[model samples]
Target chain A: MNDPEIKRRGLMLVLSSPSGAGKTTLSRLLLADDPNITMSVSATTRKPRPGEEEGVDYYFLSTEDFGLKVNRGEFLEHAKVFDNYYGTPRGPVEEALSDGRDVLFDIDWQGTQQLMESAEDDLVRVFILPPSGQELEMRLKKRAQDPPEVVASRMAKASDEISHYTDYDYIIVNEDVDMSLARLKSILTAERLKRKRQVGLSNFVRGLQQAL
Target chain B: MNDPEIKRRGLMLVLSSPSGAGKTTLSRLLLADDPNITMSVSATTRKPRPGEEEGVDYYFLSTEDFGLKVNRGEFLEHAKVFDNYYGTPRGPVEEALSDGRDVLFDIDWQGTQQLMESAEDDLVRVFILPPSGQELEMRLKKRAQDPPEVVASRMAKASDEISHYTDYDYIIVNEDVDMSLARLKSILTAERLKRKRQVGLSNFVRGLQQAL
Candidate 1:
């Protein structure tokens, strides 16, 4: 048996946030601070964007290849968004989790639901919300890349996204960056301790019983 | 309405561990580190040990008073151990939670179940385990307060307690003191983020629709 002190594979951590709510940034911070976690790179049918590489940004595939995988039920979770098929391939994520690593997903609510339905036992969901409506609008406006109408559309869409906050296992208000990040860190740390996630704990307890 | 940024009330954190697993120490560190939390002093028919106080150590109720509270259903949860009745008083804990103060309960598995059944929405249960049987025995031996036979008895009872580990929402292996304390801290922090616990998130989102 492995060392009792060492934790075995952990559950998948799915974080969903509104367009500008900082989930991507939080994911980067977690990966930088903790070595035991890896982001689950999705497989997509869409062509790679500029400077994006296969296997790094995503497992870029043709529509036919993505369709084949979908037919074979190979993906743990998948969805079509904006004319592109995006999916969490079951193989890599399972391998990562079995090796005691946490897999992070930055996806929308639809993807989260699929992941939960497929592997509810191995998933923890967190939703991030902008602290206030005015702040949310301001953040969208500051992007400056989007047209005013697009900003208005996004602001309108954000309300719908925020309405589903209760569907998440955890909801964090993105009021202060540092504080929000700290709260996310604590959630990760605590989720790791969940009885269901710690596979070694059951064996360890049994060993303790026999020794006593 | 109150500020949406403010959390409605603090949570009730229940830390359950087998005898000799150092839960008391963990609870103390959590309280010392978190200003928002309060230790929930339970009422008990058991007499105070050396250096313990009434109300502070426990409510120290007479049998009649304890029975009266139980009869009136004034306790959130209660159980009998070794012929003495111990219970968490409803009034104090409810007041504390409503006022945005977290409460800590260093209780047993049975008491944990009762509290969970009663105030599941408000409770986060964590079970702590000693690293191993040998390590647990070593720690018990170090305490030097109990005789060998008594220690053996306690150890024998530990397995039954640990069997219920899965009942808890979280579990921690207490190998290193500081690390376990950090794990407990993470649990408290993350539990505060549970979507169900946040009262105003839905209304806040609904209000945002108007701004949109």
Candidate 2:
């Protein structure tokens, strides 16, 4: 038989950053542009914001339900923030990965660590940083979602978050949207081709030898 | 003073395969295409082949000289193949990596193991396989340098080499040259962006807070 088709185990890519660092935008762009990659929808106890859909943007769950799932080990990674619990559902992410798809995580440093510790071999973590403190403040203020004081608090938190950048597997400086996106694409493309991911390679070669 | 440009260590990528599997060709392509990657030239006691230049190809060394260097722990990795001694020099490779360049090793399985044991954190191993045994035979035969008997013997040896495929991090089937090249390029590009390799990411992000 032709060497069995090399099927790769799915990969978990964590993109971590402080609030307003453009991870969400980059994740959206990645999903839209790459068919091989799929975004991992999270489960949250937090109330849905305007125009949010259950199971699409997130698995909107009650606090009790969220707590129950967490207890059942149904989360790949989980964290508490702003008086609400948020987590990556175990089922969907596992399904997507086993099907040879790449999953993106737009999460915090804690979530990144949790997933990595649990699945170090499959996890690729990237920490994104704003180009400059001034730019970070500009981006946060531009959002118009937060008041000046809240924005300042986020800026303060950013310094703390950036301190952990070395813990990630890769880092990207979001100086320009296009450039950062390009770099991200290159990284994903290259990672997809890693030898460990190409299980079919050996069998493919065997087939070639048989044919020859 | 900013982070002193904290030079990180270099990575060692070992590409191994049976003769005629295009390991050498792929290594050359990778070296020529990537300015940041340098080939780890082996110091050999064997005489140079036609068209081979000293230093550019192998660092021609006497057997006694090679033995002395090996005794002194001068080689990062080395081996004796076919009654001739061959080994990768230590200084140049280390220097290249300290300067942020990646080094490629075109060595066999034994040398690959030594590298893994010596510099496990910095090593990425790739194995190239012929698409089929028949294809392997054809490739061996097509190399006008060898006779039919030699081709058959090489083909016999290929099976033994291929049995160790599981030890590799990535495997490539030499089905089509261009496609394989594309795959190879992707692997290198992805590896270059690995989180562990970006030594200054943390400090860089910390610096960004100034912009805020």
- Lowest summed lDDT over 10 consecutive residues: which window, candidate 1 chain B? B1-10
**Over 4 Å off, model 2:** A1-4, A47-50, A145-148, A198-212, B1-8, B48-51, B145-148, B209-212
State the TM-score for model 1: 0.92
lDDT tens digits, residues B20-82, model 1?
A: 888989888888898888899889998889999887888998999999999999999988889
- Write down the worst ten-residue block by lDDT for model 2 chain B: B1-10
Give lDDT: candidate 1, residue B134: 86
For residues A1-212, could you state the per-residue lDDT of candidate 2 as single tens digits? 11245666668888999877788888888888888788789899888999999888999999999989988999988888889988988898878777788888887888888887777877888877776777778787898887778878877887788777767877777767777787787677656656676656656556644443
Model 1 lDDT per residue over A1-212, tens place: 12357566677888897777877788888888777778899899998899998988999989999999999999998888899999989998888888787888888888888888888988889998877778888888897888788998898787777777767998887877778778878888887777777777766776778888
lDDT scores of the candidates, listed in order: 0.82, 0.77
DockQ of 1: 0.70
Worst 10 contiguous positions by lDDT, candidate 1 chain A: A1-10
Error of 2 at A74 (Å): 1.3
Kindly list the per-residue Cα lDDT of model 2 for residues B43-154, writing each as its tens digit.
9999999999998898999989999999999998887778998888888887887778788888788888888777787888888887667767777788878766876677
